[model samples]
Target: MSIRHGLLALLERGPMYGYQLRAAFEESTGSTWPLNIGQVYTTLGRLERDGLVRALPGGEGGQRPYAISDAGRADLGRWFTTPIGRADPPRDELSIKLTLAMSTPGVDVARVLRTQRKATMAALRRFTRLKQERAADDDLPRRLALDAMIFRAEAEVRWLDHCEAHLGRPG
Candidate 1:
C-alpha cells in the first residue's frame, strides 16, 4: 500500500496531525495494517517536503496538523483513477519458498504445502468471523479490506491444492 497516497487520501477528509492520521488510517482499514508513529511522522515530513501537504499552525493541543494541497488533491485523484498494474507485481514469498523447496534435495514440498494450507485456512476462518461480526456495521472501508484479505487467503489455499495435485501427476 502507498502510505503517501493513503495519508493524502485521509488529509482529503480534512486537516489532521500525524497521530490523527495514524489512528484514522487504522480505523478506516479495520486495523489490518498498523502504522508506526515514527513512520507516520516521517511520511508526513516527506509529504510536506513534496508539497503534497502543507503544515498547519499548531492546534490547541500543539499538534502540528497538515492539510492536503491542490497538488496533493490531484495526486490523490490520479491514484484513485489509476488501475494497479501487473507489470511489476509484488513478490510472493510463499511461492518463492515452495519453489526452492521443490528444487532442494531432502526438502519435503508436500509437508510445506500442508503446513501452509492449515495456517491459511485458520486465517480465512478468522477473517470470515470478523466479516460476519462487522457485517451489520456501517463501515464500508473495513468491510472491503476484510473481504480482500479473506478472498486472498481462500485463493492461496486453492493454489496450494493445485500445487499438490501437480506434484502427484506423472511427469
Candidate 2:
C-alpha cells in the first residue's frame, strides 16, 4: 500500500498533523501497518514538495497540519478508480528463501518448509481468533483487513503443503 496515497485519503477528511495522520492510517488499516512518525513526516514532506499537499499555518506545538491540494484529490480519485495491476508482482521473501534453499547445499529444504508452515499456521490461528473475538463489535474496515490477512495465511499454508508434496515426487 502506498503511504502517500493513504495519507492523502486520510487528509481528505480534513487537515491533520503527522501524529494524527499516523494514528488514522493505523486505525483505517486495523493496525496491521504501523507507521513511524518520522516516516510520516518524510512522506508528508514529499507530498508537499509534489504539490499534492499544502501545509496549514500555526498548528499546536509546531505540529504543521497538512491539507490535500486539488491535485491530491485528483490523484486520490485516480488511485481509487484504478485497478491495481499485478504485472510486476512484489517479491515474496518466502519464495526467495525457498528457491535459494533448494539450490544451496546442506540447507535442509524440508526443515525450511516445515518451519515456515508452522509459523504460518500460528499466524492463521491468531487471525482466526481475532476474527471470532471481535466479530460482534469490530468495524467494517478492520474486519475486512483482518479477513484479508486470514485468507493470505491460509493460502500460504496450502502452498507450503503443495511444496512438500512436490518434494516427495520423483524428478
* TM-score for each of the candidates: 0.94, 0.97
Name the runs in model 2 displaced over 4 angstroms.
none
Residue 85 lDDT in model 2? 93
TM-score of 1: 0.94
Q: Write the per-residue lDDT of candidate 1 for residues 70-102, one digit (tens) a residue.
A: 999999999999999999989999999999998
Whole-model lDDT for model 2 versus the true structure?
0.95
Q: Could you tell me which residue pairs clash in candidate 2?
A: none
| Candidate 1 residue pairs in backbone clash | none
- Clashes (backbone N, CA, C under 3 Å), per candidate, total 0, 0
Ten-residue stretch with the least lDDT total in model 2: 129-138
Maximum-TM-score candidate = 2
